[model samples]
Target: MSGHGFHVHGPHDHELEHAASGGGHGDGHGHADGGAASLSGGMSMTSKIAVCTAVIATVGAIFSYMGGSTQANAGLYKNNAAIKKTEASNQWNYFQSKSTKQALAEFARDTATDDVRMQGWQVKLARYEQEKTDIQAAAKKLEAEASQWDAQSEEQMHQHHRWAQATTVLQVSIALAAIALLTKKKWLERAMFGVAAGGLVVGALAAFHI
Candidate 1:
């Protein structure tokens, strides 16, 4: 084609030339060249999208692992809390038993006519009181420990929630990649990759529990 024709066609060089002159006399060669170029472009795009999808899938897997781990830890903490609470209840019951013994000892001392027997009953009552005090302290310590564990577990589970959100984004990105591949839209592919980046950000935050 002439300079005027080239000027009218745009800067796409060979492609513009082909369209301008309809491949001239070598129409077969021209069409073949165009087809080859189109195939190469398609292959490049497909490879890119496939790689993007694979990366997204990997991120999703990591997020899944974190979520599962955190949830398991949370459950373990809750179990420990329950066990501590039971122990605390048992301690309180023991305290009540000690109080009963103390009351019985007091009554026996009050009724005893013999000085030696009365002194022994009084000593037993004091021992019971000391034991009850010790038991109460231990029960309180156990309850405190249980509460700390429960809070830690809850924090871990909260991190798990963040991981879940990241995983969801990664999955959505994969789906977008699928649609982009089917539609053969480069812009859509780019958008899908952007989503994947966002997923990665969220995943990192989850991993760090931030």
Candidate 2:
């Protein structure tokens, strides 16, 4: 106690104050380090997710392109089949015209009274028969070609379907990855990887034409 009514702090009071200040500074440093570590971890996870999503999107684009190409090929092949079928029909109609002319020539030859007239009619009938044979052979060949084009069209359509399937699966995987990033769930990340791998397998099947 002082005459002026002011009391100075003792050694025990000073020691207690210093200890309290030191403890507060230490606790602040600890909290700062923990926050920095958490921020670093979050940034790293965000980078990983961004990179993976980019790769998946690229793969899906490739699949979509392949599907388009196959579908276009199918259309072209189908058009070829139609053209061949039309040609076959034209040849068949020509053969029928030749057959009608050959029947009329035979009847003329059978009812002819003069030898010279009958001989001329016989020549005409033989020519008509040979022409009919050639026309029939051409028609059969055209029909066979049309059938082959139809088969090729079917095969291209099937390949297009396979590419479509692969693209769809990869899209689903990308969706899953986005969900995992938003929710920060480890199990969702695992599911995303599994689905992406399955999409790749389906893409392989499409490449091999299976």
Candidate 3:
């Protein structure tokens, strides 16, 4: 066909060109969509890992703090028990004074007063002994519990450290893989995947130990 004094293409030619252009544009759009989807998935996975790491770190910190507090309490109780025992001994010494009987008589002038003072001193001595025993028992129990907590906290800390290390390696591998994905470097991607797999294995073994 001819139009405007020039040879013109038929409708089939124009349709062919349109179809070719449309196919190219569709393929490009598909590639873009795939890339976007891949990026979204990667970001989702990264965010999940970050959240998990934060939780682990927080738990480790809490356990560490609790262990420290338990140890401190154990020490305090032991010191208090020592102090109480010393005070009880001093009070007993006062009962051995040369004027002990005269002093007691003066302090308790009436029958009721004498009985009350004697009973009060006896009660004080008994209560002090009981308190000392209780403190010792409590200190021992706290010490044992603190030891257990310390062991647990140490194990957890070790696990967290291992995980942090493993995560670092995994992050590096992922970064490399991302670069590979961008550059179409199949070998680099494969290498990164292998490294990531090793990191996962190591992390699993470390967790088992913990």
lDDT by residue (tens digit), candidate 1, 1-210: 585565444657777677678665487787899999999999999998999788789879989998999999988998998889889889989989999999999999999999999999999999999999999998898889889888988888898898899899889889999999999988889889898889889888877879
lDDT of 3 at 127: 56
TM-score winner between 2 and 3, please give it: 2
**lDDT string, candidate 3, 14-33, tens digits:** 87887887954777789999
Alpha carbon lDDT of each predicted model: 0.88, 0.91, 0.58
Off by over 4 Å in 1: 1-34
Clashing pairs in 1: none
TM-score of each: 0.79, 0.81, 0.41
> What's the candidate order when arranged by decreasing lDDT?
2, 1, 3
| Backbone clashes under 3 angstroms, per model | 0, 0, 0
What lDDT would candidate 3 get against the real structure?
A: 0.58
